[model samples]
Target: MALAPEPGPDWSAALSHLVLGAVSLHAAVRSAPASRGAAAGFLLQALAATCTLAPGLGTREDCPSGAWVATVIGLPLLAFDFHWVNGDRSSANLMLGAGMALAVAGEHLGPEGCSVAGQAVLLVVAVTIAIVAVFTANTYGVWGGALLGAAGLLSRLDEDGLPLRRGDACRWALAAGSWAYCRALRTQRLQWE
Candidate 1:
């Protein structure tokens, strides 16, 4: 009998990096401050949404338009980071900014050169991070992030194989994260009121 082809390095690295990154981001957001940290957390959730959406419209090559979209999305995120860092934002904001910067670095490293598995892993990581951010941030941010991450994960599954729906799990995590944020916010509001 013929043996199955071994998965490439890109696949393993992508998934591993994503999971690790998510864990790191989650920790960073948890310790972040209320103002800019919350904004940075939302930005991460937005990134998760973008990764999920990118695949469905077309492959990276087929859609130059997508690159434009990426630029538009990326610029504001960078600005957000800069603001957080330079404006004497909280240490939590700085940490969140650092986490996002790391994620962007990972994306640049992976790019089109990475294998399909690698891309899937990246999405998984993104969703995981977004979920964590949601729980640490506000209700609106959590809900929006969860929805976007879910859509992204679903699209990613369509491209890759079905046996492991890691993307889907990430989306559910986002939802859970959102729920956590909502509960936290409600509690806070009740105390204030």
Candidate 2:
């Protein structure tokens, strides 16, 4: 007999990520001079969204390997997310990258390594990075770090046998919408600048 799928919350949040990612992609395409960095961010967001949306082969219960990998890849890319809108702060991007990498590393450490402690550290670092982005007025990056950071911690719920829930959808939605917003806003500003 075939195995049954796990029961969980309806895919409202998961579906939201899919739509937001499409809109983000569209916005990125519209912004002609947007940095290659922004393109990378949009693509990563789409990948993560797709992974969560799938019910495909090798897809894990209430989540998939693809989703997990895509989400990880997005960590560093997020540092690049608001580049177009904020006109690029090379240093801020660098710090954001390093911070996210640290946070992700912390997750793998487990209880002995203080996995939860590491996650908390990440949340703090993420906020700090976003604040720096805000200080320089990197609107999208600010949004990117803030939302993605929350998303990062929330994905933890999917670890072990925890069922996928609103948290899963929320993080992806936060990421996709933030990217799309930054892209659209930047494109509009570029026309006037």
Candidate 3:
């Protein structure tokens, strides 16, 4: 028997991701030499968003959990870029290692088998990014990271517990967070210039 058709994908959320990716790609290209690390981080983030949009845009059959993993790996790159600017490389290597470890753990957990754990990993990375942003006085980063963390939490909520689908809420928050992150990159590029 033929299976029922799935609902159409969230077009607004997909559009936001597309915008985020484009802006981030622009940031990566326009960043100054001293801000190459941040540019690289932006590029990685863009890749993550691209992964998220792939299924929705019909480039893939399903969303890859690699999006979260990539975000996890990219967080420390951003956190350390500012740290490096401040002449503090002592914890940069350690954080980078930790980010990689977290990415591996998140991947192993698998969103289907353990969505909460996967989302929790996303929360951890997002919170770390927010904390780092606060320390660095990056307003956009602080808000963006917080929104991303909120999205993670929202995604874990039961569908029956809310008036609207939790997935929709999560997607809206994720898209907003992505826009904020793109703004963060823009601000960082300006500082570098």
Candidate 4:
């Protein structure tokens, strides 16, 4: 039997990313001047998502690298912003930055390497966010951290051609985490104002 052609790009995933990106943009626009760093991280995600929204401009295969690069850079910015927003300079920001650096290095090693790198980035970002959440006493932030970590784990354990693929799970987790984080950012802004 002749092999059927593969399906086109996943429109749902792209749409979700676009929506999340828009939410992030709104948060950024509402944030104060100094706190815009966190919003900047989300903006990168938005940019990556926008690129993927166009089938001709960026196919799925072309999007992950952009997404990964954005995540790699964005997570630390968010972490550092938290550090400044909370007015508590912890060495954890340094560690988070180092972790992102390592993830970037690992991504260059190949698919397995990229998977591991992605996992590490997610874990570090999760842990950092969790720390910030604890300091802020924001329960939603804690859940956001958990979701991000779970997404990382799911991505790492994902295999090819599963009925419920890892990418879908990760996307859901990311969306939830992003929403929670956005809420947390809002709370932080309110507290400071």
Clash number for each model: 2, 0, 0, 0
In terms of TM-score, the best-performing candidate is 4
Give the number of the best model, judged by lDDT.
Answer: 4
Query: How do all models score by TM-score?
Result: 0.33, 0.55, 0.65, 0.79
List RMSD in Å for every model shown. Answer: 12.3, 6.1, 4.3, 3.3
Model 2 / residue 126 / CA error / Å = 4.4
Q: Please, what is the whole-model Cα lDDT of each candidate in the order they appear?
A: 0.42, 0.53, 0.66, 0.72
For residues 170-190, could you state the per-residue lDDT of candidate 1 as single tens digits?
444544543444344343334
Position 119, candidate 1: lDDT: 36
Stronger candidate by lDDT (3 vs 4):
4
Report the lDDT of model 2 for residue 192: 38
Q: Arrange candidates by TM-score, descending.
A: 4, 3, 2, 1
Query: Model 1: runs farther than 4 Å from truth?
Result: 1-89, 111-164, 189-193
Candidate 2 structure quality by residue, lDDT tens digits, 67-114? 433344443454444443455567446645654575467457554454
Better of 2 and 4 by TM-score: 4
40, model 1: CA deviation in Å? 7.3
**What does candidate 2 score in Cα RMSD to the true structure?**
6.1
